[model samples]
Target: MAATRQALDWPYPPFEIPAELYAAWDARAHGAAAEAAWQRRFDAYAAAHPALAAAFERRMRGELQPALAAQLPALLDAAAARTDAVATRKASQLALDALAPLVPELFGGSADLTGSNLTNFKGCVIAGRDRWGNHLSYGVREFGMAAIMNGIALHGGYIPYGGTFLTFSDYSRNAIRMAALMKQRVIHVFTHDSIGLGEDGPTHQSVEHVPSLRLIPHLDVWRPADALETLVAWAAALQRRDGPSALCLSRQNLPVVTQRAHADGAARGGYVLRDMAGARAVILATGSEVSIALQAQALLADAGVPTRVVSMPSTTVFDRQDAAYQDAVLPPDMPAVAVEAAHPDFWRKYVGRRGRVVGIDRFGESAPAPALYAHFGLTAAHVADAVRAVLGTGAECAA
Candidate 1:
């Protein structure tokens, strides 16, 4: 084969099959009859179910129905209009309810944490002995669920997503990395995202999972702040075809801090949720801490220090934005303080030299979420102090 390639001066690798084997295989398989037989089977299936065939055709072409896309604004508004705070996981369930029926190609499952993860919707039903269902119940197997989703995605026609606690992602890390490496559109709904999981302690809480997941190339990690952001993240995950997405959701209820008007900017990954005139500093936050950032912004304002609160749900997506947009959201000159219930190192790149990160640098303790937040100094007061300390205008946070 190597000599044949050299003689022909061909850049392509030469076939390695023996002459007899190649001739026999070609004589048996290469013919008009083989092509016609395959076409006949495809035509019979298409004729039997025209609608299903059309849907598969559209999916293969990478086309999302306009009806599905148009439903997003209404979904976002409805979620934003909620009178009380709701967990991002619950909001994710609501999104699945609204979108699942519309997207017949959406296949969902959970790693035996469906109730806690809120991954199921009306359209998702576990398969029975006598019937097929849209959702697979992958019992207590995070790695298996993720690996299976990768296989389903590679097979095409369906968009596969699975759910599990954020901490358990360690079990699925290899498959998640493979999905990113293969540039497959698999969605991982990781709930109970932080120490906010509370009394479950360090075992259930995730202090480094979010940052470690972010480090995976071609993986878009979204830690949405509220229902609106959750809905937008789901839509973004579905629309993104070149890579996988991780939706890290909070276990505790988060107040609606994002505005419906800023939905477009939320889709961009990061945006100024609240901006003050003559702002002197910026507080960057994500997930449940976004509400904390807002409170800190208010405290700073009361202290005669106007500040801007930036809700950065997905830093990976935000980094892909044009320089002008990125700078407009997080000004280079502004002293920044990043607040998250996670590791501190990941925020340093955004906060810069003089900035500080108000985050938990250690394993969580078994306690109520509020107490955990207070103990770790992930409160609005501590965040405000961090901001003030960075601006060189106040004492450092002692927490």
Candidate 2:
């Protein structure tokens, strides 16, 4: 091979040369020259792009920033003022609309589901064949989009993100795993998170995706409840530098059940959203089901069964919290019940032996979201009933 390479002039490494000579040549000449040239180019680029250079510097310094985090309260306040329910995906878009302009290092795109994913916002420019742009138009290719975002994150100088339906995350599974394994800061926007994405049927429903993604070590899976939680999820994804984040958003509109005061606790991954005197049980929920849990809380109150509601958006993050905080939020002695529009098995660990999970363990049908929720027993009354069952009280207990 060496002789053939020499003859063909393929520029193979010079094994015939003395080891000392090659080492000395590269250390004093080739390597030094390359380092100097690269340094000069880097300095030029930094001078040309001050904002981007600063963003990279902040990232390298591990500055989990609060400046951007401080702005979240105002956004939450704005969301609370709105009377209508908002889809978490659309809420995420509103968040991006406010924060994207401030983050020059943020580069995002959608896998040909731009309208549905709401990843692209106003003032966004698509990367063309010739010149570079902030966003990509990854057409109908979930795996390709995820892999390319991984490549971009590996290359540095930009925070890469991509969007697709929650069910389609299966296609990007390997790439998403690689991101978690490498501890890369890549964000995945997975909308249509549950049977709430009605009419799409079982093929498009994401019954197991959120829990499956949570099983990935080092990856943060956030199923935010409302606009405020959605913004917090986005901010958390941006601040995290050691691992990837998956934002499992909702298709159906979620009532603004959260308040501005919950912002700090929300960032903790889980917090008690509603506390009641003489509470006999705790109801844990995420995403669209959070509102349902709140409604269940009301029903339980009316039924003379006091219960507290805990909005647990990110179980991975919650698990990382201090034992004191975890215990404070979820006491071991308390009977707990979890409600979500996904697989039931994932909640079993949290709910304990005495508790139960109100979730869909079967395939969804094509129908309106409300009808699906009703058929699947994902309603507030069902959750209230679950709490009653866990507490050993039946319908007769409701006054």
Candidate 3:
């Protein structure tokens, strides 16, 4: 094996020339050798899977972008051009298709956790959920998982996404934060959100994770309320072309919600999920937490609070909303509180000093989610208490 010095034009140190790997010398070399090596690999792949090979070639040259986007041509071809909501739901499919060709480094696998995380990408790999057969698997080692994700993103062209229990996100917090700082497009599929995680116990519940992740600046955290939103969220994260994104999903199957108007859900970030009356207070929530907020709205209504619930999947998007829109969603007359199983840190801006927020703001126990909710104050009663506190009907509780 022959090795050359690092390329002056390139950013990092030189790569090692493996003694036995073919084209190891040119992996870092300039010109024809690199292109030729790619061709050889492509031809071999094409011979084996012609469909994938053709798609891969189109991707290499950048002809597959618009088709991957949920806009005109491809949408028309699919005969779903008029169905914006359905198109939005298909964003994840488009993402996988668009990404399948460009970054071979974009690898994913679940920890016996694919169904929950939505971490499996088609035309990719087949493996036991516990195994790393799909290029890389972090297993249940969430810390290492996040660290490896950071490495892949920092190295470039590799958008690494992985699956994990939402509660386990705490273990990988630092690495996740670093990915945010570096602004890499690493995907994190966090499942089993909230007490909805059921008998899994407080140990598996992710009450604090909601606000903790929202605190990261460059990290676009999206807790999609349903399957379509999940697809859209993944697509939006990929199109970010920069920054890291975390998708918080649920263990429980959420009802599918779609509208023919919001086909570009992924790119747009956030839109009115179901806006009725822009009432006095806006109930902001995400993930499994959103359901709580919706129920609270009805409870508040019978009590005469007259509230509006906003499914704010992306805080980053809500923050970017114009001042008028923000004020409209969250009127000054009606003080609001953010309800989620997580901490309250992420709600300060929206709920404000005058408002209230219902969140975990604490650690977890080894017990189950029901008991944990009792301990952490995440029940419907707790949510109502938060609303009353924010509305000045009750005193503020100590953090």
Q: Each candidate's TM vs. the true structure?
A: 0.92, 0.89, 0.68
Clashes of each: 0, 0, 7
What lDDT tens digits, residue by residue, belong to model 3 across residues 1-399? Answer: 123333433333448445564565545456778898888987998899998777666544423355346453343233323233322223443445545554454578555566556565666765455764444555678888888878866765455787787778888888888888877777887777676667766668776776778888888888776544555576667667558888777666544443445445333555544444545566776655666666666666656555666667778766766877766556667667777777777778777887777777665566555566577665555665567666655542232
Q: Which digits, one per residue and each the tens of the lDDT, describe model 1 over residues 166-215? A: 99999999999999999999999999999998899999999999999999
Weakest 10 consecutive residues of candidate 3 by summed lDDT = 80-89
Judging by lDDT, tell me the better candidate of 1 and 2: 1
RMSD, every candidate, angstroms: 4.5, 4.2, 9.0
lDDT tens digits, residue span 1-399, model 2? 878987987664655775676677766676789999998987898999988777667755545445566766676677656667899999999989988866667889999999999998778889989988989989999999999999988887788999999999999999999999999999999999999999989999988888889899999999999888888898889988899999999998888888888877888999999999989999999999999999889988987889999999999999999999999999888999999999999998899877999998988999999999999999888888889988888663332
Estimate the overall C-alpha local distance difference test score of candidate 2. Answer: 0.89
Question: For candidate 3, what is the TM-score?
Answer: 0.68
Best by TM-score: 1
Worst-scoring 10-residue span by lDDT in model 2: 59-68
